[model samples]
Target chain A: MFKATVNITLRDSILDPQGKATHHALQNLGLNQISKVRIGKLVELNIDADTEEEARSIAEDACTQLLANAVVEDYEITIHKKQTVS
Target chain B: MSTTFGIIVFPGSNCDHDAFYALDEVMGMETKFIWHKDTDLSGIDVIVIPGGFSYGDYLRSGAIARFSPIMNEVEKAANEGVPIIGICNGFQILLEANLLPGAMMHNQQLRFVCKNVFIRCETTDSIFTRGLNKDQVLDIPVSHGEGNYFISEDGLKELQDHDQIAFRYCDEHGELTPEANFNGSVDHIAGILNRKGNILGLMPHPERAVEPLLGSSDGRIFFESLLNRVVGA
Candidate 1:
């Protein structure tokens, strides 16, 4: 088994209402130094694969095909370890 | 044979019945309800993908549902020049399916919006709007949380050059103004057609306004117009 973490975010050119709202809220709370606040999702998964490379590919496929919509979003996957201990 | 309006029902599709009723009862046209799992679309002349939270709008609105088994046949039908209209969530699914370009984003307010909106008919080149004149304003209700439409700059230029835009939210007087743009859509676009013009995806719910009791019958005109083209042919 291999563990992976995926981060999904709106494309740079698109405006994120939620992220902008959050940024305003932060400013109200006195976090004025923050240049920007972009919101995104983090997905964690454990996959069963013989090799880490295979698990990474599977995770990427999930992101592109289902987990993330390529039209307005982008995704990145990172493998935690070579394999998970039973 | 009479024209058959096939309404595809996904697991969470709530507007299928409305669409069916609009086509069958109100317009007195032939209609059928199709299951999402069905792989064959042999007898259908027109396909309608109605709105609601398909796959619970999981992963993304219309992302998971786009991969449904029936979509393979849907794509085939679209390529064969079958008229397919996707409303609200159905529009999201069609975008995710890549049958239509661009994508939907969260409403500018980051909240679900449900209300009546006026849309300017941007084009009437397709069978769907032959009865309406260009820039004709139609009262349509759009209900969705993720209806903000976006497209690349080049894509918008191409859409304009090809006359693929079908509808754009506008003021009651048919003026394109910031106040009338409900969802912060690109150029206030509320709907568009594929390059071939057979496939249409829009954020408004035309089926909901098919009767005067629903506040307006402009939506009825949409269905009526399509039936006219099919029956005339």
Candidate 2:
């Protein structure tokens, strides 16, 4: 079994109001050195596959089909071996 | 000929009955509620994906609802030239389903904006806007948190070239201004049409404005236009 983590973020051209609001709050806390702030989503998945490549491919499909919307967002995926607890 | 309207009811759709009341009671037309799980859309002359928090608006608005079984039929029907209007949350679902281009983000103010806004009819070519003249302004109610529409520059140019823009957020005098853009949509876009012009996705709730008792009757034109297109055909 493999675990996949997808990090989805709004495209650079898209304006993120939520991130902007959070940035303002951070600035109020004296975090003035921060250059910019953007918000995104993290989606994790578990796939039963023969190989890590197969698991990654499955995760990619999920991102393209559902997890990530291509119009306003971009996504990155990472796969890791599922650690089973005895 | 008789025209039948179908309003798709997702799990959390709150505006399904509002659409029903506008179409069935006010307009005196046949309307039906189509459950999200149902795949059949045999007699629906027109489809209205009413506004509401479908699937609890989880993850993203209309994200989960787009995968509902009814969307398959909605897609097929759209391809066959059946007219479809997705209002507010329905508009988000249409975008998520890829029936219309672009996507919706949170409002510019980062809060749920509920008020009467003015939208200028940008084109009279589509079935939904045929009843109104070009540049006509309609006072419609919009209630949504994520109504900010976004599209790439190239995609927007394509829409401009194809006359696919159906409505633009405007002031009372039909002027496009920053203050009028409550949602901060690109080009102050309140609604848009698909390439074929059979599908319309808008952030405003036209059904809620169909009667004078509801604050404005300007939205009646949308239903009248669709009825004219289908029944008159």
Candidate 3:
């Protein structure tokens, strides 16, 4: 089994209203040092596969098809082999 | 005097009956309730997506509901210019379905809000609001947690260029006031129409305020507007 961690975020040019609101709040709270803020999602998945390549493909497919919106969002996947006890 | 409309009801949908009653009883139109698993769109002139937590709002609001079987038919119908209105959760579903542009994120306050708001009509050319003026104020109620709409700056410009903005926030006196902008939407947008001007997705619940008994009947115009279009056509 392998674990895949996916990070999804809106394209840089897209306006993230949530992030903008947070930035405003931070500025109001006297945190003028922080100029920009963007919000994204971290999704984790467990896949039982024979090869790392197969696991990576599955993760990519999930991200492209359902896990993320390609128009406004982009995603990256990191796969790690799960340690099994003897 | 009766027109048939279908309300797509997912498992967690709680406002299906409210939508049905509002259209049938208040708007004097025939209504049908369709399940999400059904892949049929026959004998329906209008398709409504009522407000509710579909699939327990998992993996983002309206994300799971977008993959439902019935949504396939809804997309086809919407492309053919069938009038479709997605309210609250329905709006999220529409966004997930890609029938409408942009996305809905959590409110700025990161809280669920339920309150009455005033929205100004931004466009009168769509079939949904055929006779309404471009600047009419509508006192409606909104209830949702992820009702904040987000889009790219170019996307916003495109929507404005296409005249697809269906509604904007406005004061009680029908003035383009800043305070009416609830949830911190860009350009004070409250609701919007698609490029074709047939599909509309808004966070406000028109079904919840269709009768005077509900203390506000301002939302009735939305139903009345669509009904008049169908009847006239």
Candidate 4:
């Protein structure tokens, strides 16, 4: 079994108001070294695929079809193998 | 000749009745309430997707609602060049359905803006704006948190080249200024039309403004303009 984690972030060209406000709040806390901040989302899926490639393909379909909106967001997928305990 | 208007009622849609009142009561048109799960759209000449939070605005505004069964028919109707109007949340749904271009983001001020504002008619080429003069200013009320419209540079250029922009946020005197763009939309766009000019997506609540007691009656004129087109044709 493989677990797929998808990280969805607003495209670089898109504005992230929530992230901007957070950045401002951080600045007030004296985090001057922070150049910028952007917000995104994380989605995890557990698939029963034998191969990592099969699990990745399924995750990719989910992201493109529903998980992430291509117009404003981009997504990255990471796979991890789960250990079986029997 | 009468026009039959279908108001799609999605879960959590609060403005369905507003569209009903304006169409069925005020204009005396045959208005039908279409449930979200229903896929049939036959006999409906005009479709109005009203505003309000759908699916609790989960994930994103209009993201979940776009998958509603009725949207399949709505998509088919759009492809056939049927006239469709999406107001507020409905606009967001249309964007998600790919019936319209661009996407909505949180307001630049990081707050919900609910107030009366002026929108200058950008183009009179669309059926929705047929009754208005070019650059005419209409007083409308906008109530939303994620009404900031965003599009890529290439997409923005396409909209410009096609004259798909229907309305722009503007001052009372019809001046497009930074302060006038309360939501900080790109190019101060408040409403837009599809390339074929058959669909309109706007953040302003025209149904709410239809009655004078509610506020401005310019919204009444907006509906009347559409009525004139659909019926007149």
Candidate 5:
């Protein structure tokens, strides 16, 4: 079994309305030190695959096809190999 | 000939019924309601991304909706040059889908604004407004928290150079007026058409003003224009 973590965020050029709203909320709560706020989604998956390469391919396909929107958002995948019990 | 148009319904979509009514009652077009979970896009000539707080406005306005199964079909239809319109929150979804340029940010004042405004038709060459005259003012209603459009200077120039800007706020005399520009949009832009001109995304709710009972019937022209195009083709 392989584990992967995916991070998704709006493209730098796109405006982030939610982030801006949150920033204002923070300031309203007296957290005025924050200059900028950008929000994103984090997803983790466990894949059963024969090899690390196979697991990575599956994860990438999921991100592109279903998980992340390549237009306004970008995603990164990090895979870790699981160790077996002796 | 009756043309079939599909209105996509996300979980929190609030404008699906309004869209359906406008197309069916006003334009006399066949309409279908497609769930966001469905991945099929067969037999639909026009697909509408209705306005609403999809996925409860989680992550972002249209972030989660962009991953719904129906978007895959919507994407395919857009590539085939099928007509598509996204209104209000639907406009945000199109940006998330990259069907249209630029993204919607919160109002400069950080408030949810709901009001009637005037929009000048910038181009009549698009499938959505083919018969309209340039610089014509149409009174429409806008209601959204995130309607401010942001684009880089180069991108803005590109849109201008290509005549992709479909609508801008204007006064009764068809003069560009900031009073009608509700969201502080760059260049007073209120709507835009894609490079192919078949896809359009606007922040106003034309569907909400199709009848005189709704206060103003000026929005009827939008549906009439699209209906005429579909019938003519």
Candidate 6:
């Protein structure tokens, strides 16, 4: 078994209302040094695959097909090998 | 021949009944409520993707609903010259389904704006607005938190060059001003048409105003006109 993690976020050109709101709240708390804030989503998937490469490929397909919307968001996929107990 | 409509009812779609009433009762066209899992669209002259949060608006407004079984049939019908109108949430789904370009984001004010809005008809070449002349303004109801439409600069130019824009948010007097753009959509776009003009995705709820008793009846003429186009063909 393998685990895949996908991170999806609004494209930079698109405005992030939630991110801006959080940034404003941070500024109100005197966190002035922060340059920018953007929000994103994390999606995890468990795959039955033989190798790390196959797991990563499946994860990417999942991200493109369902986890992320190409029009408004971009995504990255990471895979982890699951350790089984003997 | 009377035009029959198929209103796709995805789980959590609240506007399915409204669309049925608008097209069936008000417009006098035959209408059916098609379940999301159904794929057959035989005898349906047109299909409507109504407003409301389908699939609880999860994973984006219309994202998950795009995968519903009926979508394949919807696409087949669309390619066969069947007119399809997606209102509000339906519009979002059309975008997610890749039937239309661009995406929707939260309103610029970050709130669910529910009120009467003015829209100027941009093109009468399409079936949905065949009766309205260019620059004609209609008062329609808009209620959504994610109606702010966005597109890349190049894609926007393509839409404009092809006159694919169907309607634009405007003032009551038909002026295109910043104050008139309620959702902050690029180019004040309130609705758009596909390249072939057989598909329309609009954020406003025309069904909500199909009767004088319901605030305004301008939406009545809009649907009435669309039906005429379908019937007259």
Q: Put down candidate 3 lDDT per residue, B1-233, tens digits, no spaces.
A: 45689999999999999999998887878899999999988989889999999999987789899999999899899889998999999999998888988888677667788989888888889988886777888889989888778877888999999998888877888776666766767787778899988899988888998888886888898778877788778
The residue-by-residue lDDT of candidate 1 on B1-233, one tens digit each, is 78888899999999989888888988887899889899988889999999999989987899888888999999999999999999999999999999999999999888899999999899889888877888899999999999999899998999999989999999999999998987889999999999998998999998899888999889987777777886776
Off by over 4 Å in 6: none
Against the reference, the lDDT scores of all candidates come to: 0.90, 0.92, 0.86, 0.93, 0.86, 0.91
Task: Tell me the DockQ of each model, to 2 decimals.
Answer: 0.79, 0.85, 0.30, 0.72, 0.21, 0.71
lDDT of 6 by residue, A40-64 (tens): 9988888888889988888888888
Alpha-carbon runs more than 4 Å astray in model 5: A1-86
User: Which of the predicted structures, 3 or 6, would earn the higher lDDT when compared with the native?
Assistant: 6
- Per-residue CA lDDT of model 5 for B88-144, tens digit only, reads 888889987788888676676667998888898999888888878888789889889
TM-score of chain B of each: 0.98, 0.98, 0.96, 0.99, 0.97, 0.98
Error of 6 at B78 (Å): 0.8
Candidate 3 lDDT score relative to the true structure? 0.86
Candidate 2 error regions (>4 Å): none
Regions more than 4 Å wrong, model 3:
A9-40, A48-50, A70-73, A82-86
* Index of the highest-lDDT prediction: 4
Candidate 4 achieves a global lDDT of: 0.93
True contacts kept of each: 0.75, 0.81, 0.06, 0.50, 0.19, 0.50
lDDT of 6 by residue, B1-233 (tens): 66789999999899899888887898878899999999799999999999999999888999999999999999998899899999999999999998999999999878899999999999998988998888999999999999999999999999999889999999999999998897889999999999999999999999999999989999988987797788888
Candidate 2 lDDT over residue span A34-80, tens digit each = 97999999988878888889998999899889888898889999998
Looking at model 5, the pairs that clash are none
The model with the greatest DockQ is 2
Candidate 2 chain B lowest-lDDT run of ten: B222-231
